[model samples]
Target chain A: MKKKWLIGVLLMVLVMSVSGCKKDDQVVLNVYNWGDYIDESIFDTFEEETGIKVNYETYATNEEMYTKIKNGGSNYDIAIPSDYMIEKMIKEDMLEPLNMDSIPNFANIDDQFKDLAFDPQNKYSIPYFWGTVGIIYNTDLIEEEIDSWDALWNPKYAGMFTMVDSQRDSIMVALKKLGYSMNTKSVAELEEAKALLIEQKPLVLAYVGDNVKDMLISGEAAMAVVWSGEASTVIQEYDNFKYALPKEGSNKWFDNIVIPKGSEHVAEAHQFIDFLCRGDIGFLNADYVGYATCNTETMELLDPALMGTTYAYPDKALLENFEVFLDPGDFISEYDRVWTEIKAN
Target chain B: MLKKLSSGPYWLWSFIFIVVPIMLIIAFSFSVPGEAFKFSLDNYKRFMEPVYLKVLARSVKIAVEATLICLAVGYPMAMILARMHLKYRTIAVMLLVVPMWMNFLLRTYAWMTILNKNGILNHILSFFGLPQMTFLYSEGAVLLGMVYNFLPFMVLPIYTVLTKMDNSLIEAAEDLGANRRTVFRKVTFPLSLPGVLSGVSMVFMPAVSTFVISDLLYGGQYMLVGNLIQQQFLVVNDWHFGSAISMLLMVMILITMSIMNRLGQDGVEQGGGNIW
Candidate 1:
């Protein structure tokens, strides 16, 4: 009786395994992006319109996405990584150059965003969203206007503010406050930044990430160093919270979509990129994600209230203070060591 | 022949899942990043730096503290559970295990909400006119998280050992004019040492290697060895150094386990024979 039962189970397993392998003629395009980055409704719309199945995934950081793609087992066709990471991937030859003819919507991108440092010829990546890093503070907590990064180190506000947990962002705050370039490669400059951070460590309530938003909303902190996108969402929801672009300047960043080398569905990946670039689609994503859109048509479609706000869309003069993050290449280890030392201390 | 054939799948599973991955990690630990098949000890040398060693020492310190706390609290609870009425024993054990069925990360996240500055604990404290304290983002909070999560591992093994203990032995000591305390000191505790050893290893192993607990509870300020390794591999893209740290952690754990095993054997010898 046991033998017969075992045979029956084995046959059932064989049948189930075979059925699992069965696939329809539809092509599946695996699109990996930041967690909570896009409108979920767009997936259904894209699938319905194109008949290309969307296998969507999310990663929390650019490094995580880069590691997974570089490791080479995952079959992800498209990934959205930041400017520095895109540059690193291109230098490593891990990205496939885009065929611009396949994506006519490339013309929709603003000329200012195009031919930038990361991909000068716009070969490997397409601009998705761009924003700056700044401080989001509650007006009721601090009486004075916060126009400088030095406000972070004020002993009066000790234990009332948080810094970004990221290595580059936190180091940039220290460097900018000291009047050094945010992308300084000098060992002495980095050591000085490290010393500043270590000195400020006692005053910091915490070094936090995405949960900074929740902390601020609950009044756990008076201020936090945050990406402009996160600040925009919090500012729109809360009446008292305001974002400041410190006069000492800060990091401007862009997250762009790129196809990893050896993607099985390149054609479908280009199609998805084109679909994402449509004005209506870009508007939906930009509005949903609370990040500045790169598409000119999407800019025209944005809410007038948001456009009028300098923090969300800074004017030309204000833009000059922001510098795009450059890939440090081999010098990133110095950053790693400095950050480790600060955290260890 | 049939028995050997039946065990074939087990050996194959171990080879594919366990043995190969370990070999890969060992290989990576000894190699240089960005250079193919070039062997070097630079990764190990880098880990010998003071900053990384301090991280290692902190991880060990916290793990030891958490283990001791678990033992202090869990031992008496286990003894009580073992001595309880059979009817109550089931309910008590169920209560201990029910919370563990929920996700580990979820339980840690729940602590964040309770310990936040404006969270439930502070609210209660303020309601009673007590000053609000910062409970989250401290070494204490991280230690509390570790003890809370791993307490069950400490309790269950000791409970099993206590319950399975020979009642006749205790009765004989009583009949021979030995008091309860004398009997427990001379007999019961020695026999339960094996369970204690296993429990210590179980709790200490995970506590030492945990990154998430420190990351969430201490707000990235507290750097543990686990977090150091995670940062190297994920953020720094330096797998060689990460692998070296992981290998060192593995060696430390192995040494600890072997020491515990030796102690357990000595306990068994003192108790007159192996009880398990």
Candidate 2:
């Protein structure tokens, strides 16, 4: 019996290694980008047309993605990072200049999204989707009309309001309320922003990340300072939920697709990017997600009602009052430190 | 024949499930992931931050407190069970074991349902003309969850020891004109120390590292060492830093286990006499 058991054990170990090994020979496109921000079926279409097997990857935050790419994630063929992150990546020399000549369908891009601060000549990043930060409120809960960033901290809405759980975002809102720059490098301005946040913390329901949409939807909090894309999704789900980019200045955050320095399958990636830029495909993604689109053709193809929704796409006056977050060199480390201190306290 | 048949299956399963993965983690612990999986030392200094150290210390402190509470609460309950009539003892044991049959995460969440500001506990308090209470998102909730989850482990071990205890020895003490207290101190307690050690090991090991309870009840406000490791892997994508921190935690656990082993062997050398 003992000898038989020993034989069985050896057989099992032999079988185990056989099962554990992977030998996938599929043409792999390792695409890493923001989670829940893309339609994965697009990969299936790409695969069906071109037999390149797509390996879909996701990152929750830009910093998290930055860390991966830094640690030799040259394995990834493409990544979508925000405009500021794209700027930081370019400065760090981590991106490849998009051979725009290879991508003729790039003419599909809207002029407004072109020539932004990150890539002045639009050399590196291909703008994927764009939106502004804003307040999402339950119209049933708030008695007064909400217009400005200060309305979030108003004692009248105390304990009923929630700001974004993110460090840069929440601090930016406080900074904007104080009429300071969203990209302020001044330590004095940052300190004042920090103090205002600490004071406002008592009024906060919680500082959370992706849970902002759920929190507002569940009626746990009356308002959440959230990405306009997520706010639009919520307003779509429940008609009573209202969204407003603060009457004061708001930050416009845009995400763009950039090929990293060591991407192996650039041509296929460009083809995939072109496929995404198609009017119907772009409209499908934007219609379900509710983020304003950078694809001019997608906007023209969207339902007139969806296009006209104020929360989905705010007017020009509101757009002018907004600022873009800049990659403020060494100030970011300080920004991170201040954010950590605020969270700690 | 029987030994051969059983031995092969056990060794095979253990090797496949336990030995190989542990070896992999230890290997990965040394090699930091670089571009194209190139090795580097850049990940090792990641946990030097004060934030991570505080969290590790907090985990250790909370685990120790939970283990101690389990010891104090479980030993007496187990003793009473071991002394009960057989039929009643079976019923009591069933009752004690039933809570374990439920899902641990589900049970922890139930505590949240009862303890949140608008939860059952607060509603009861308000009904009694007392003010409403906020019990969720506090350290007390975390400790409570830990104890509730681990109490079964504490009680079962000590019960095993107490049930195996020789009643003949107790009678012998009584015959020598010794009181119950003296008998217990001299005989009963020493016999159960091994069970106490086992119980402590089970509760202490898990409580020190578990992150789910804190996340669910405490709003994940405070980071423990476990949380740091999770954030590195899931959120930060800093595997090298994560590996370095994991190596530190492994060393900490090893040092603790070595001391425990030495003390445990000393216990054997002393004939298990110093139970109290």
Candidate 3:
């Protein structure tokens, strides 16, 4: 009996070793992206069209995606990170320069998104989705014209409003209200922003993340500071809701897809990127996610109702005032310190 | 030799998964960010600031409150379960274990739905002509989350100890003409002290180190030591300071467990009996 049991165990070990060394007849592309950012059916369509299996994973934030890739434990062929993080990764020599020739669909992207600060010359990244941070307020509860950041601080709306809990976004709101750059390195300016946040804490119903959309939809709060894409979705569901871009302006952000330095399947990654840039695919994703697509071809295909929406296509006058958050470089620690103080207090 | 060989897999597993990770954490705790690993004390020094200290103090305060609340609620329930007949006790224990089978995140999400301003709790209150209660993002909400999640940890250990307790001691106290209250205080409570200590440690350890409960229930406004460490590592990418905070939290928990162990030993001696 003992000999038979030992033979069974040895057979199992041999089988496992054999399976581990099986020959790869098909290409596999590992893609990591933000959670709920893509339409799920796109994966199946891509796999079927290209005959390449996709190993898809998701992260909640750009920083989280960076840490996983930087640690070198997991290798993903493609990652979607925001502009500031993409800048940080490029500086750290953690991204590979894209071979633009392989991505002919790159021509479909709007020229306005090209040659941006994070990856000037489009050397290492392609813009995925671009949106602005704004306020979503209930028309029923809010009687005034909500066009400025000052509405968030009004004591009349005390305990009736929510703000995004992200460190950069939350701090950016205060900085814009104070007539300071969101990326200001001046300690005095940052201290002023920090104090404004501390004062606003009592009036904030909660400092939430994506739950701002939920809070607004459920009528739990009179107003919520939210992203343009999420705000558009909430507006569709609730007729009483309206999204406004404060006249002082807000952070205009872009998320882009790029290949990390050590990714093994560069060719397949390029194929995946080019496929996503197709006008139909881009339109499908943009419409499904309620976000603005960077592909100019996709823009023409978008529904007229969506094109007319202010959140997705803000006025040119309003657009002129938006600022993208720059890479803070060594000053990031200072911002983190201020954020920690705000939360701890 | 055969027995030693039989335990070889366990030793290797612990060495690889447990010992190696801890060694790396200690190495990271003393290293500087954005530099090659080397011995430095900057990470620990950074934590000495009053801002970080206040976070630590608040974490300890809230954890202590949750642990005490657990003991107050759990001890009586455990005692009642222990004293019940076999069939009824089994049904009661089953009811307690049912919630544990669900994922903890799902359970926390349920609380979120119930406590929000337009949630079921407030909806019911307003239906009865009462005012709405906004309790979603408060310290009380955080405490509620901790207690709801960790109460089972407090109950199971005490219940096991009480079930295994010797009945002869109680009979002896009764035969000596002692009343029910005297018997409970003199015999049962003293003998159960070890269980109480273990339960407190179990509850306190997780309560003090949790980030998700507070982040979700309190709307990410409040910062605990756990949240501080998480933000350092994940958000700010400052693993050095995160590692140092982790080490400090580990040492703090170790000291607390040692004190509880000493008390348990004293309880054993005073009761003139040994707990399994």
Candidate 4:
């Protein structure tokens, strides 16, 4: 009689657990974005405004995020990846086209951030944050006004500055210095860029990633090739550091949000993206992440002190020198080989 | 029939987790990217290039150096611990192991702070009117990290062997007119050979394949074979080449292990299966 009672309880528990595996009625939107790229409180606010649950995830790099999404087991509803990756994903049909009717707040995005080369019609992605790559230097270390990429290669600054560790960013510096497009496909142009980088490798104190900001602030490296957003953060904190866009030009980047092709909660994903695009929410995110926002409404709400700052928001003429990174497609192998060879050497 | 039924789960687990993944890796290694089901030696051919060969050579060299350093430092530590009183031995062993309880990356990051240009080490140097050094982002820093992390692996196995060694054999050698140095040289060192061999392999394997230590310490200025394979899969999205590199690394490790096993066999026979 006791054995029968225990068996009955076990059967009941198993049934309950099995039923628990079934999907709940509440919608959950899975969002994958770069690490520390959002104002996390916005998620709670979003959940309050809409009943959809926000399941947030983060990745450290575009390549890492792309590899995960490309492998396809992760059924993320929305992802925020940079321009070139969005272009690649769209080409591969990994992205679902945005329904303009669903995303009404996208109209608040600035005109300059729209119809970018990656998304010519702005169909698949909405601009999340945009910034350019530039040099952030310690003014206290060098007296002369720094304006060009050649300062990185100067013998005087050897072992005093860091180059970005990223393949595209590092190669872009060399290509721009050589007066070639960052997205150059010609083997000769790439070879020249490779040679330039190899020559400059010894002078570089280190090849660093996002930690370049900390290194610069700590005065480990007197100068670093960094994204404008990171530079702006350091410039705001320190009196000695200054940001400069070199005369030879540099790459501009945009991180944009898009719904992945296999999203189960398409409507909730649209609602979340629209929520993020709202002016006050955009302002909160931009303020927290310290990146330039695409929403013009958010721009007006920004701190007046940061307006027209070289690192934060440069003038239109200075912006003309920046080129957006385009998807190199299969030609990226050349870049990988070149980068590996450089590091190996 | 009962035993077979009991072992069924083990067989299933191995088949699903170990056998299947290896088969997949082998299949991927033989194939070319963008061309499905087409087998090619192109990935292996690419790895043979001088740039990649140098990376492999550098990785082996660093691993060897780290292993040697561990052996040098750990052998003494093991001896000291083996000779300690029971009450103190436990405390000493725990001291060696306590830092390992912390996350490996966190420990490595702590080293970065100590070795940075304006870090604790530099502050001490400046305080004493000494020149500050750029100790981080160099090959030396990476080596230091490998040795610091893997030293316990080298010590623990050797310590177990030394502690388990028969005291009668050493006493017998002493009675046969052998001095302290001669007794240790003959009995202690030879019996400890199996432990030493296992320790070398344990330290060498992880040191060679560790990407995180070199990534954080050298700041990606230095490339190793592990980093190359990581770049192929994660950055370049070329699983074929990555798998090929992984297969090569596994083969290299197997070859080293077999060589060590051959050396350890004679010691194991003499030491009575305390190889650890």
Candidate 5:
């Protein structure tokens, strides 16, 4: 009787501790990725075709995803991160290299997307989507041509602007505005950028991320420092919206897919990446997510409006002026401290 | 000896989970701070920045204000329930507790649908010919979210102690021509202080360290202690300073706890209502 009573108490504690909203519980294939970075239908299609119950989870920022992936004790099967993160993960040896022979459909990816800077020689990661950092604007709200970086800090547009809410992007803007390289390694340039940001902070309505799309479309903002892919999405919904690579310079970036080390189902993970990279699937994914697809065939299926939009696919001259964000390593803490100081101020 | 063995398990838990983590944090705090390694004590020195101090001060102010409101609202509600007959009292307390059945994150997120610019509260305000207020990303929203999440914890402890009061003592006070206010001041209120201390401890610590609700509802517009620690460990990739901040927060909480314990006589000499 005592043993039965003890078992009953334990079960009650389990029940009380549980939140109990999970119903899609079979053998779960957990795929973790950055927020709004994947096509939902691809997961559904994978489920229907392969009969694997895919559990899709999202993280708002790269750091958040890393925190869970680090502390979760190797349970995640598949993860996606930006290029710099892929480099760091490889250095930490936290990822297992993909077996390229198992993923033949990866051939659909354009040659330009392959063997990129973050993973020279292409050992650990596969490129997902590539974009350039630039100015996304409300063309109707501004009367002047915005072919230069000065258009962002114009006094006439005070309280009418937004910018990326991060040390890297915001500081890069100041660096470029001052005619310096976007990836300025000089501490003097960074300090100058910090001062420039302090000047611009009051003019900012809010430092926002995901809300930029809704706010820009609704006319709450006239311009924002935005990702090219996000700029593409918002531009499709409103004619007045447009984006450009500042005449000075900008950052070029690509997100990549990789398997975290100690993945239990490496085969399924590679299969998923391969399946999504096929021409039709890649096209659908690009169309739905409103990002530039890396596949050459998928590029043809893109909406002509999106195809012709200079912001989505910048002219070669503009693309040439872009620099990739290198992993700043130990300097990251200083970057964080400076950012916290800015926010607190 | 059984006494030493009995203390051993608790000591082990404290050392492993609590003390060791705090020590690790302190060590990280003293590292020759760089982006990566070759550590120093710069993070602690860096903590002297006015912005960090402002964030710390704001977190404390908000936590203290929430604790007072929880106490003021909780004390009366707990007393009334305590005065109720046994059958009705049980049902009343359970109703207050049923809202906790929902997931904490889900409950906090639900507040967004009610307080956002286009949310239900504004919709009702428009219908009533009142001006709509954007409440979602403000400091008030953070307080309301914390209070809602933690009120029950405050209520239950106070209620448990209030219910244990002998009716005869109140009757005795009234027989001496003392009015209800005097009876409460002289007899009931002083006696219920133990429950208030327990309730305060339960509510204040969690409110100060709240991680998710404030971020979701306020859209990360405000920085509290938890968000600061989160930024350090995750975004900045600086676990050393992050650990130091954790240690600092722990020390602050310990100091507060000691002060509270002194006020409540360690809540031991004060009688506890039976929970088991």
Candidate 6:
């Protein structure tokens, strides 16, 4: 009699637990993005309005994201990779073509961001944030107006400046100062760039990565080669610092979101992407992350103070002089060797 | 047989985590990437370049310097701690270990705060009317980071050996009319050689292969072999080259360990069962 009663209780518990799980299980969309790239509050709002769940994860660099996706260990519904990585993924068929009918807010994207060199047809990726490389200077230390890349090579600023310790960005600066294309593949052009960098090495206080902000804001270095977003972010905190677009031109890079091939919830992913594209939503994210939004509608929604800043949104004429970094393909080895030689010095 | 069967989980864990990964690395080291997993020597050939050789030599030099500094500092502290009363010995060991409980990166970054040009160290120096110093982002800073972080590893092992040492040996040497210096040189030092060897190896391995310490404290100006491997794998997307470097590093470490082991064995033979 006792055993029969225990069996009845067990069955009741199992049925109740199953029903509980069914009620709480919502459409889950997995998102992979750059570390600290988005406004996290947006996720909470989306979950409340749409009754969907978000599984958000972040990677430090594009190469790390590519390796994880290629391994197929995780089922990520959406991934945000940089321009060159998006090109590589599209070429390798690791991404799914977007269904535009589901994303009507796609119209908000500026025409300049459309038909990009990485995804010319706009079939695979959506532009998220775009920015150009420029020099950030400390005004208190330098009385002169900084307008050109040559300021970095000034002997007077020796041992008082930092350069971005990235192979492409650093090499691009040298190439541009010499009046050559930032994407030059010629051996002589690259060698000249490497020699120029070696000449300027003594003047550099350090070759740093993301720590350039702290180094500059604290007056440890008089100048740094930094991205436009970092300049805007630091400008809000320190008034002594200012950003400049060099007359010699620089690399304009973009980060975009795309769906990897192995995702399970494609429709849910589309909904999330569309939700992010709303004008207000885009403005909140751009303001929070301090990056230039590619959304034309978002620009209209932004305050005049934000729209007026050239660091946040540079003039169109200056952008025309910028070049995007292309995938170097097999010649990437040459770039690697050149960078190693410089660091080894 | 039943007791041996209980160790199955450990064997499985080792095979999955250690043995398999090592095999994969060795296989990848010999092949060209983007092709079949067939054999090729090109990857290894690339590491024979003068640039890579220089990086490897510098890594060894830094590791050795850090290890030697740890030994010089740790030996005296360990000895004093071992000689302390039971209550105080516990407190001393705890103090040495407390810094390690915090994240290593946090500790290294703290050094950055103290050593930067306008940092706390300079502030104190300038307050005294002394010249401000550029101490951060230099080789000395990197060495300081390595020694500060790895000092505990060097201390604990020697402390353990000193504590376990038989007290009668020192008394025996004393009764034979040997002075204090002679007792330590002949009795204490030889018996403690095993701990010293292990401690040296422990500190040397991590110091030799560290990229973060140099990258942060020296500002990426000093690229060790570990940084070279990291650059190839993550930035250059050349897994073949990275694997080759890993294999070379492993062989170099293996040779180092064997030499150290031989020295330890010689100490044991010379001590003639003096160590417990």
Question: TM-score per candidate, in order?
Answer: 0.96, 0.76, 0.96, 0.96, 0.80, 0.95
The collision pairs in model 5 are A330-B35, A330-B36, B30-B40, B31-B39, B31-B40, B32-B39, B32-B40, B33-B40
- Which run of 10 residues does model 1 chain B get worst, by summed lDDT? B267-276
* lDDT for each candidate structure: 0.91, 0.78, 0.90, 0.91, 0.78, 0.89
Stretches of candidate 3 above 4 Å error?
A1-21, B270-276
- What lDDT tens digits, residue by residue, belong to model 1 across residues B214-267? 999999899999999899989999888899999999999998888777878966
DockQ of each: 0.85, 0.19, 0.87, 0.88, 0.27, 0.67
Error of 2 at A18 (Å): 11
* Candidate 4 residue B228 C-alpha distance from true site, Å: 0.5
Q: On a 0 to 100 scale, what is the lDDT of residue B166 in model 6?
A: 90
Q: Which regions of candidate 6 fall more than 4 Å away from where they truly are?
A: A1-24, B270-276
Better of 1 and 4 by DockQ: 4
Model 5, A159-204: lDDT tens digits are: 6777776678778888878988765667777778777877776666
Cα lDDT tens digits for candidate 4, A1-345: 775898799999999998876646888889999888999999899888898888999998899999998888989999999999999999999999889999999999998899998998899999999988988899999878888999999999999999988899999999999989998999899889989999998899998886888888788889999988898888888989889989899988999999999999888899999999999999999999998999999999999888888788887678666788989998999999999989998
> How much DockQ does model 5 earn?
0.27
TM-score of chain B of 4: 0.96
DockQ, Cα level, model 6? 0.67
In Å, residue B135's CA in model 5 sits off its true spot by 4.2
Candidate numbers, best TM-score first, in rank order: 4, 3, 1, 6, 5, 2
Comparison by DockQ, 3 against 6, better one: 3
Error of 5 at A61 (Å): 2.6
Ranking by DockQ: 4, 3, 1, 6, 5, 2
Q: Candidate 1's residue-wise lDDT over A1-345, tens digit each?
A: 775899899999999988866655789999999999999899899999999989989999999998999898888899999998999999999998899999999889998888889998899999999999988999998889888888888999999999998899999999998989988999999999999999999999988888999999999999999998999999999889988888888999999999999899999999999999999999999989999999999999998888846557877676677888888988999999999999999
User: Tens digit of lDDT per residue, candidate 6, span B126-217?
Assistant: 99999988998899999999999999999988988889889999999999999999999999998998889888988999999999999999
Local lDDT at A88 for model 5: 77
DockQ winner between 2 and 6, please give it: 6
Top DockQ hit: 4
